[model samples]
Target: MVRRRHTGRRLRSDESGFTLAELLVAMMIISGVLLGLMAVQTSALVTTAQTRQRAQGTAVANQVMEQMRALPWASLSKGMHASFASAAGGDPNVTSSQLHPVADPSITEPLVTSTDQTTDRAPLSGAGGSNKTVEADPSIPGFTYTSRAYVTRSAQTAANVLTLTVITSWRANQTTTQKHVILRSQAFAPTGGCGDASNQPYLGACQALLSGDAGATGPTVTVAAAGAGPTGPVTTPTTPIIPGTEATVATLSVGTAGVGLTSQQATAVEATATHGGLQTLTADAAVAAVATGGGRLTNSASNDAGSAGAAPANPADVTGVGSASPLTVSGTGMSLQLVPASGTSANLRATTTVSCATGVPAGQACAASDLTGGGASSVVLTTGGTPFTVASVAGGGSAKTLGARFTSAAGTTAVGCAALSGPGCLGTSVKRTVGLTSVGQGPWTGGAAPSGLASVTSYTDATLVERGLSQRTTAGVTTRTGTVSYWNGSGYSTLTIDRLTSTTLVTPAVTTTVGGVTVSASATVTVTPAMSIASHPDPVGCSGQGCSVTSDTGTLTLTVTYVVTSGGIPSAFTAAASVGSGRASAAFKAAPSA
Candidate 1:
């Protein structure tokens, strides 16, 4: 039983808790392990924060570098300062101030600020203090960042190398850390004796070189001089080079193996030596003395009659010598004349020889044969009406004949007119025969009529009369006097009838009595008789030959005498008549045989 108990106890003890020292030892070991893990986590968090701070600092440094690069190179020179504000939510109470270089280091230093110090202290907020706040906001705390840039010059012995160093610093997480970046650049500087120092427009790099700075170097250069001595040690004398001048002068050594100055600098040195001679020098006068040529000049003045001298007849000819006693001169006068020789003739004659086959007349029709006179001696018509004298005659031909009625002027006659048919006169006073009365009249009935005339009862009469008498009546007789008298107690008859003659037949009468009661009438007659008729034969009836013959019809015109009569007396008769159709009858009269 005891052994069973012991076994049970052993088992119990095997499953039971440890002793005090053993538990203490285990607790110590666990504590060491937890402590080591906590340390590792803490270190990781701090390293991450530091890395973040370093990245922010690098960003700030880049911003500064960009700003400097963007500025004009002149503004980036020494003693130039600038201020910048932080971005939003980015240290509102802090500011950065730049400290521009003024001396050899040629550096720019930037300072950052803290919020509390910058807001509370006015004097401490100036650019000299890094805590100065460019933008102040109460809600957020701010910290300042600062940077400084330094130029590293090349070694005086080396001409091709340049170096620069930049240092950036910031405060974060209660600690200050810094970053440094280095840059190197290179360029060529002018060498040889040909460089002119005065010709160097940009003096920054050169000045830096001469002053032993050698930072941010530029292009190369050489030196030359207008008048330079041979290689030797040259000494500047104590006495003034140009007397009585206050200008400062110096002598510089130029050698074959050592440093030398540019040509422009040598010129300046020489000019400085000479400038000591003059007290007050004018550039214009000095330049003018060396220039060439003077300009042409003239002068004019107006004069009046009463001003100073007497007036002359011609202003242009008012010379010192009088015109009446003109001075003898070799040149010819203005109005010289020369006459031609006395026996020389002034006329000029031109003869043009023409070949003619025949002689032609003036104003006459001509043919090609008329122009075939071969070499006839015809005188040419002159423009001035001077007769042309024929010098000689040769190769004469027969003269062409002209019209009989044509003639020419006396000098040397030529044909003037041509024989050609023209208009001719038909002759005056063409007479035409016409019958005065018709032979057969209508059958007369119960009326007294002449033997050969019929008592035409159906005759229509158109009569007209002029009541003036050509003769004047006196006592009981009619006389050829100008005055006309009416019958009163003067024994002059009121009515009288005379036998009708051609002159007394003014009141042409047509008498036709129906029952013989003296039906006598007078008429102003317009007589038109047919002088000629133009005939056209009509086609025969449509039958064989020997059918009834058709008469030829024609147009007839009449020429008749018209008389104006009045008061049963003759007055005047007109030679021409106004006659038309139906005023008389269209009697068919047989045409006369040809």
Candidate 2:
């Protein structure tokens, strides 16, 4: 039993041997390792979340900015607000007021939309909220997010350049994490470049800044250098005279009294109004002296003038011969009668004479004579003589005169005529007369001779006319005939009868017979009067009222009577006529006078 008890004690000691300190130490080590692992995981998760949040926030910010940029820049400064829903949320009902950050407070109240009303509430207090948050609201049932954006003007220049910052915050594993993103943006006035007055200085600064060494820091300003001004003119040096050249001088003089030294001597003379001190000389006196020494003078005189001689006068006399005298002769009756021609068988003769008041020239003489029968009938004469000739003649029969012709050496021609026998038949005469007459009616008989009538005449005996009409008519017809006579100078020659008809009259059908056969015939006739207007006013004067007949007695109608005879017997008769109104037409000048 004692051995059993000891064994028990050993077992109990083995079971209770591990102390509390050792146990506590082992627990501390395990806890530290686990805490370290947790910390590492937390840090990694926070970094990843921050990066993700930052990326998301940056994307959201870029989207919002793109939208705002699309709007006119003027709208931004007017405090216009725009709502941007997170893309992660399908619905635009959920919102976050912390979409803008605190760093640049210019963006006061940016808008946000979300599905959960609680998520859409402001994340912080006041106008805009901070960009931080814990777990996503369970009410939203989606990842919760906080975002903030801010805008700031660049201090470098007055130009409308803005820097935008977006911060996103959210809870991850019960720890808050924040991410930051930045972007640059700009708003422009309507004018393309910035309108700020201070931009000029800023531009200079920017140029200097760009040219500075890498990593340079400080204000940049450039200064310009200065310049200089102007002066006067330079004087001319005197020219030196060369040696060994001859100098020649000339002087002239005039004999006139008041001619002093003239401007002609300006190169040689040196005259002054006051010389040395006291005396003064007149310009005239000086000029006079110069003129006298220069020998320049003038003299005047008077004389008479006469007209130039006239051309020689034309001669008063000339020597030449004049034209010869013409021959003259006269006679009466058909036969030539002359005292010198008593013995001549043919009494007609031609004579020519020549004379010279101025004696003939030494080598020339005049001669003239008459030409007789044979080939010498033509006369040829010499200067200072006379010539004559007798020509054979023939008389004109029947009391008509013959013509005599004479020709001169110079080709002058003349002709003469004898007397005529009958009165009014001296030269030539012609007469004509016309007469008109009617002849008795008769059948035209053709003959070789003209029947001694102007036109053919027709004659009809009462019985023969009736028989002719009956022969021309049909059977069982009775006939009648008429006769008319006209005197044609040689007693009562014959009579011509014509049937007249009124063409204007409307006719009626009449039956007649011819050659034992029945025949039908009709006639229409009209007669227009040849009337005269003795005295009537112009038609225009009576245009409204009908014209008045000035001479009614002169107006006459031509009556045309129509007779219908059957079987050579008169059956019915009608008359139609027309007369012109005694009215004158409006006078239109037939021809205009020049």
Candidate 3:
């Protein structure tokens, strides 16, 4: 194709594609929109990260709550706790300061996380940094959660009711600011159980509670209702109603009076004398009667004076609050006196007239009477495991038979018996006395017998006897020699047996103190010198031919006496033994004629 020449011309604004200034303005607008979109996307990503961390915090809080629930009642102490050390430093066993309180309005809430990387001087980029947790978000490298717990007991229910609060916190994107979640729960521990010290009064009390029903009704109430009327009732008989005759009255009577107003002195005096020409008499009249009846008496009279059944002019105004009336009685010469019982003390005395079986001269005192009909009404027991001691004699001079009580030694450990108590319940202590242990001798050995007599042989015989206490030992030895004889067809055959015995006593005697009482044990033993033949000729006599000798044996007796003394009382025991009880007999048998 051929080229053609064209001339240049100006175009309209609508026809022009673009200008440098317009292009710049348009580029700036497009860049602005793109940057705004990018900013929104970045914000969305951060929000998603924060939400994920919040979710993790919630899970961590729940996990801490579960841990608190797993702890037994005995291990849980009151106050805040954390897996790591707390910011508000204190005894970690009590309260922790690891997760510190939040900022500003929510400062009361302890929401600070352990891995708040910004709080420290250096960046908490590594897992080894302080306040870092192993439970870090694997996807979000440096993010971690911190968990804490608090425990408290109810005022009304005490340790039986426990409340637990768990908190979990974490830093948002490794910043100083933290987010957290809280959870609260409660735990219960049964009261009056075997572990409680108050529930145990003795071995029996704790044991009984182990098998007792905590919800059981009162003992007097026959049936247990949904809502009982009282916690503990003395007596509320539903069946077999109590009769009025058998029922007890609130107030007791003194003699014939409905009230306890009669004085002891007034009653005793009235029984012994007459007053004012009337058969009934008062205390003053009784004193006068005693004076007239050849018995000297001194009177102490005030309110009633010498009048019988007379009321005082100004009687005690007991009706008014905190009012009192004073009556004074003073005298020196008196034949008899009576005293009332008081706090921490008691006294009683009486004397009876004596009529001698045989006549006695005047002005001479009668023979002293023998006391009788008196014995211990009750016994007081002390705490178990106290060692027994002689202390002092309970019965005074005249007592022939005395009583004593014993208990286990001190530091004695208590044990449990399935037969007496339920599982985990302790039983009473087991006590045993140390006593005589053994009496024995050493073994016998064979040896040569005495020679000189034809066909005579001897063997050593040994005997032993010994006695000892629990903490002692003993030894002994004895010996005897004897001859055994047997008859053949032609003559008598004899075997001389000898015994040499020896024994050593380890402990001849021993003494020890038990409960302030001296105890001693000793042993004495002796052996009989004479030996007796225990068995004789078994084949009878030799029959018309040769006779052969056989083994023979003799026996001796050993007597032993053991003595033990305790608290000046001595006890004796005896024992005996026979030596060479089982052995061959000294006998000859006749051979068959050839």
Please tell me which predicted candidate would have the highest lDDT against the true structure.
Answer: 3
TM-score against truth, every candidate: 0.21, 0.19, 0.25
User: Clash totals for all models, in order?
Assistant: 34, 65, 10
Q: Per-residue alpha-carbon lDDT of model 1 for 229-297, expressed as tens digits? A: 233123133222122222112111000000000111110000000000001121233322111111111
Displacement of residue 354 (Cα, Å) in model 2 is 99
* Candidates, ranked, lDDT: 3, 2, 1
Residues 402-479, candidate 2, lDDT per residue (tens digit)?
A: 111111111111111022111100000001111121111111123111221112112111000000101111111111
**Candidates 1 and 2 compared by lDDT, better number:** 2
The sequence of per-residue lDDT tens digits that candidate 3 reaches over residues 1-594 is: 999867877788889887899999999999999999999999999999888888888887777676555432323422322322434332222314322333222223232223332222111112222222336777876777765455554444454555666656777888888676767666554554433544222112222111100000000001000111233123332110111111111110000000001111111100000110001112233333111111111111122344576433222211110111111111111010111101111011111122111222221111111111111111111111121110010111110000000011111111111121112111111011111111211110121111100111232332221111110111122233544322221333444444432221212333344343332222222222322232222223222211221111223332222222333444322222222221111111121111
Model 2 ranges with Cα > 4 A deviation: 1-28, 72-101, 104-155, 159-182, 189-594
Could you tell me which 10 consecutive residues in candidate 1 have the lowest summed lDDT? 267-276
Ordered from best to worst TM-score, the candidate numbers read 3, 1, 2
Candidates' C-alpha lDDT: 0.21, 0.22, 0.27
